[model samples]
Target chain A: MLKINDLHVKLEEEDKQILKGLTLEVPAGEVHAIMGPNGSGKSTLSYVLSGRDGYEVTGGDATLDGASLLEMEPEDRAAAGLFLAFQYPVEIPGVGNMTFLRTAVNAQRKARGEAELSSGDFLKIVRAKAAELQISPEMLKRPVNVGFSGGEKKRNEILQMAMLEPRMCILDETDSGLDVDAMRLVSDGVNALRSPDRSFLVITHYQRLLNHIQPDVVHIMSNGRIIKSGGPELALQVEENGYGDLLAEAG
Target chain B: MSEIAVKTKAQQTPQVTGAPKAVTALDDRLAAMSLPQGGFSAPARAEALSRLRVMGLPGPRDEYWRYTDPRLFNVPGPQPLPFDAKAPESPLFAQRDTLTLVFVDGAFDASSSDELALEGIEITTLAHADAAGDHWAAGLYGALEAAGQQPVKRPFAALNSAAAADGVLIRVTGTPSKPVHVLHRRAADAADAVWHHVIRLEEGAELTFLESGMVGARSNAVIEVDLAQGAKLHHITAKRAIDPKVGLSHLFARVAEGAVLKSFSLAVNGTHMRHEAVIDMAGDDAVAHVAAAVLGDGATGRFHHDDTVFITHGAERGESRQVFKKVLKNGATGVFQGKILVKQGAQKTDGYQISQALLLDEASQFLAKPELEIYADDVKCSHGSTTGAIDEHALFYLRSRGVPMDRAIVFLVLSFLADALEEVEDEGLRAEINERLEEWLTSHA
Candidate 1:
């Protein structure tokens, strides 16, 4: 469902390069996890794919269903069924969470030539989905992530992920701030959205999150490129021994 | 207050100098035309005219006119700008039951106004009452405006007091059944409308005054309020001129001992607009709040808005707050000059002032001047002003959620004005104002 052809990116304001010749692919119906240490261009990969500003795609190609994702605007990429669960959700002081969610859901639908949902329809859908994630009505009414806890913010991100229902989802360090219970709840929310037509590319630094979501394939990334790919046992192997041993063995 | 305080306040103010260029400009511009007529208001008009001549119209050289150019109003006559009469939205303050008083091109529209009397409130129009020899509002016709000009010159307000043809004079003896709505509708394209409203609330009485509608192509307005001891008054204005119009307005209020005064204004659009407010806490423990929410989009037409406020704590334990917020984009401009003064012996006085602007683009700008003067040893006063653009990260967050750039901007802009809107005490009125803001943002965005 998602393809990257030796992606090369650098900081737009400086000569420093962040991602160098990184390539990865995630087919439909499969969950892929990219485990990498810090400063390995993991978050940059997600931001680059999502078309965020301040990044120069020096030499690379990222596509969704054979169409170049690099050419689309951020919102257009969203309409084309790409979703990024931000590592740090933004706090929009005066905008209500529900207002943002509804605007997003309807905007995407309209951009895709689908009829917009009525307020009643949207409210009903959001309420049911929010209840499943243990989110209260008051939380939905508050300003977007203004005073949310770490767990609450992550859960809010997952709520957004569930609502957008994008064809390709990129989880950029979604497990960084979650506690054990929050991690379980967030993984459960992601697990419930699993389907044949949907794909998720989970990015994490540790294998703890992998124990919950259980990825179909695991790739170890180092210095902006994936150095190894293996099955679920590789995650357990890294968990038992840190990335230090693995990096040395791979070298 | 019980008459004595009013006399004392009158005795405290110093004299005003003469410099009324606006008066001379008005006279010159209306060489072939007749300015608004006055009868019982003659003495007050004469006093205001002399004071305005000394104050003179604001000029580029004036210290008080540093941020906003008074040249547009100083000209003999501003060019006539057409107003859109077919606006799809309903008039502001129409959602509630109000004692509606309508005016057309500065003249009182008797046919369109409600009855002259409501329970506990006596309403008199300038044409009928000012034409005669005696009236209750005569004592207050230009008294407060005269007091407001001493520290800083307000030439237009004096010009308004000197020449305003028609307006409403309301005296409240008790709590009114419904609020009063002053509705100004435009008739002529070039009507240089000027109006003055004098309100006196009796001791222990209460009233809510709502002002809305388009005054005229070029207009100057003044509303003077006197709140008696223990009385309460709420004043709100929604400037509904969405087109490129030029106007200036002033609100001068005297808050008495134990009395409360709150006022808020929402300015949506105008080519050039200025709003000035002067509040006097004459008695002990008086509380006053003044706030404004303004939006200017220079994409379709030029836009500039200015808010100037002065609050004086003359007595002990007075509390005052000033909150002003503006959202400008596409080369629009906003300006704010606010001051709080705590007099000697006004111990434990509390004053707060905050002015902020959200600029959607680099071309837009906001200018602010916040001041504080204190002679009291024990007082709490704070003032702040900030100017910033839309958060790029926040914008991306919304857009990444599928909202377009324009829509996302509107969202952030509305959020930015939320602080100013909190000044409105009534929930229903606040919601209606929000609706008006939302519609304006959608079209402008």
Candidate 2:
């Protein structure tokens, strides 16, 4: 479970306020969706939660399982069961996909005081998860995200999530740039990984991904603050009417 | 030509046991042909020898001689090892049924070398080939001597030309069922050494020549390779010199039309090592590739390197690529100069070059210069050079993942050298090079 309290964040260099007086909480065994139009600071919130550098926390704190996540480094946050599926993944040449994934998985495991997996067992787990996600082995052999198409990169991010088995996973614009069929495959992969002890924060600009993911709670954000929250129907309402009404209510 | 000042002290000067007078006369004869008197013919050979005389023996002042000082052999200089020096026991060629040619201290060790049993392949020493009226063997001996009339500052290259008696000549006539392996080594430990090796790949012939300088002896050598029409030659030279005061090495190569020349030089040790390679794309559609990985530690090591590739349109549609990477620690230094020239008539020429260096500490040094001259408008040519320390972010990333500081540095350093090592085609040879790399990192770390 994760809780964010009165979080106020500003741009590091300019000190321009982005997230002001925002508070949210997601308990275990639940799915939450944050929907907002462009420039509403939805993506910024995810980055701040994950402890990415260059984001100043002007006010409150973020906690993971009662532990302060704000005090941890980006990698430390990752080791403490936090994963962020980037909107645009950086391509690192000469670092093979399989090698990167293995390093990340082992790093988290070591941080949790678990023994490292052998090469044979690691290959077995990677192959099974790749097959389920329809990712070819050749993709795993190339450098990390180098020359991968939009949909394939997204699927790879999901594959890493499945391999890591993090406690809280954040998906930012996961459905963008994906064909309808690819969207379904990715949503299916995410749904399969859902469990009682794990939670997901699915943030997107459109309602198309909701058709497959079916989040338990939907929240509308405006200018970095949550303006409305309701059941799954809230997503359908926003999709039919757009964010015009929500913007007015928040203002 | 002035009396070249041998950089080593008088005591360690090269004392040619039987041929001291011959070397002295040769040196004086070269001096008499000085440019002031117009006695020197200014031929490629004359220029090369004069340059060698000037370099004498590399001293410590030359920036390129920093890590590898030739002064340790000061008292005796360099002397050709006895032709009868015992050859070390190596099973490299015995496993593959390859034609083995052995050389000790720059002279052909005929008793230890085996004759070629393969059909249509002629593998013989330069002396034997010349004795059998092999005109090609004599013609290409000093063919690639540095063309410019520049003063010779490298003593080993000059010594190799002056002292080389019998060199190895490998000629692949018809397409071979298996590649011919030529192993030229400097195994003599007591004295300074010189060996000249020449390999020619004739028309439409394909061959792989594996040359390893694994001998820990002090050596000054020249290796010249020529490829005829459509001939393909892959040359891999591993420089693992262990001696503390050995001079540098100079390598020269010439490639013809539709001919493919690929070479990789691995310099892991040696007090002062310099590998200078010049390639000419004489025929249309010719392709040449040069790759090297150099590692230096301890005292200042020098890699006075040069790669000048000329792609002429008369040999239209030619391609040339050069990649060199240097990894230096302690107070060692590296120098890399790469140039690609595309003549005006050479349309559709593809030329690319990249030189990168990674310095491990503040005391270490790295310098890379990449140049490109394009006269043809349609040609695609680009050159890039980068010198920097390791990525702090990546290093931190590895360290936070539980890898200790030393292991993390090794990972990043090896990743930088991986590009050049990939050019090596043989799996076994690659493994050997990697083993040396691992040892170097562990010892230095």
Candidate 3:
């Protein structure tokens, strides 16, 4: 389970507050979708929780499985089973996607005091997962996201998530640049990884993606705080009427 | 009596004006040392010595050496310390089937060297070749070096030409089945070693030349290569020396019509090291590529590395490229001076030059001088120079995936140099070089 209470965040370089007194919690075996408009601190929350640099947590606490996530390094946070599917996956030239994946998997394993996967075993699992996601062998061989299309990048992210199998997954705008088909494919990849031991925090703007990967709970975030929490029908309500009604209701 | 008076008068008149004390000392040392007998042409030696006297050892005031100080290399006296000759754990080119030629303290060790015979190639020591008789190598000993002296003056190369104790002469009549490996080891810790190698590839011939190991405590080396029409040469060098060594190596190559020349060098840690190369594409449709990957760690702010390269496209449709990459950390210093020149009549020429440095820490410094001189109106020439720290975003991305900080840094550094390493044509050699680089990264980390 992941929990956030009175979370306050600000940019380290400038005196600008992003997340102000936000509170949210996603228990085990549940999918939660946070719908927000522009500048709602949606991305900031994901970055801060993932232990990214340049973000100062001024107040409040966030934890994963009752352990604090703020004091750990980014890698340590990752080993603690927190995953962030970036909105714009980085393009790392000269590093093959397969090499990156294997290194990541082995590193996590080592950090968790588990045995590393052999190359042959890693290759087999990766190939099967890739085939399911429509990732070509060429894409897996090329530099990570160097020349991949937007859909391919999203699918690659999903592949990484599948490989890592983190307990708490945060998808930041995974549906932004994806088309309808890509959205379904990515949603299916995500749905396949769903289990009682894993939970997903799907951060998105529209309810279209929610239609594919149905969330058990829907939260409307505005002004750096979740103004309302409801069931899946809330997404339908917001999809029919925009945030204008939500803002009025929250006020 | 009259000749002695004239010489004294000339010395008093300061024929070498404004030369540093180190330069004068170097001249004195050269004058005192006994010159090798025979194989070398007398006139070439005299001319090179005269050039060295005029240019002097490059000082900090010299434009080309503004970033690097040549005083350390110009010190007099032989290296006082003896090098430990128990070969390194992983000697370069150890896994290859090569014609290995070992040199101990600048002297060729026949006992450790392979037989001086190979298919389609001829090899002989400079002393033996010169002692035997005048041959093809005599014509090329200092020919390309003297030609490279124009436009920019290399006093160290001139000194090497004038005072080299011993070297090798290799001639390739056809494609050689195996590569020629030159492994240098320093037996005398403070030995001041000088050597000049001559290589000539005949028309339609092909050869690969490999050089590795530490030259010596204080070493000056010059390698001259000539590729005839339709010939090809692949030259690779790895300078994997331990600390407290100063070395200066120069490579001068000329490519004839339809010939191809590819040279790559990897330099790791050293107190002070500089590798200078001058390549000329002389005939039409000739191709030349010169690349280097350098790594320097300041060991308390003493390590320094410089790569100076000048490539010329002289004939029409000629192509030339210069790629240099350096990774410096912990106050280490890296310097790169690279230029690509296209002649006026050389139409359809293509020239590319890129020099980049990744400074791991704020104390590390990188100085780059990238130049492109295009006289041909229709030619394409481009040059770029960049000095930066590691990409933080990329680092974060990697670290976020559970890779440790140190491993992430190593990965990024290797990725930065991967493009330069790709210039190596042989996959096996490339892997060897990669392993060397990885070793360096792990040790440094």
**How high is each candidate's TM-score?**
0.91, 0.76, 0.94
TM-score attained by chain A of model 3: 0.99
Q: Between 1 and 2, whose TM-score is larger?
A: 1
Q: Rate the local accuracy (lDDT) of all candidates.
A: 0.86, 0.69, 0.86
lDDT of 2 at B357: 74
Q: Write the per-residue lDDT of candidate 3 for residues A192-215, one digit (tens) a residue.
A: 999999999999988999999999
Q: Which candidate is the best by TM-score?
A: 3
Give the Å error, residue A242, model 2: 4.3
Fraction of native contacts (fnat) of each candidate:
0.77, 0.07, 0.64
Ranking, TM-score, top scorer first: 3, 1, 2
Between candidates 1 and 3, the one scoring higher on TM-score is: 3
Residue-pair clash count for candidate 1: 12
Model 3 DockQ reads 0.74
Clashes of each: 12, 22, 7
Error of 2 at B240 (Å): 3.9
DockQ scores of all models, one per candidate: 0.68, 0.14, 0.74
How far off is residue A204 in model 1, in Å? 2.7
| B235-296 per-residue lDDT for model 3 (tens digits) | 99995666777888999999999999999999888788888999998999999989999888
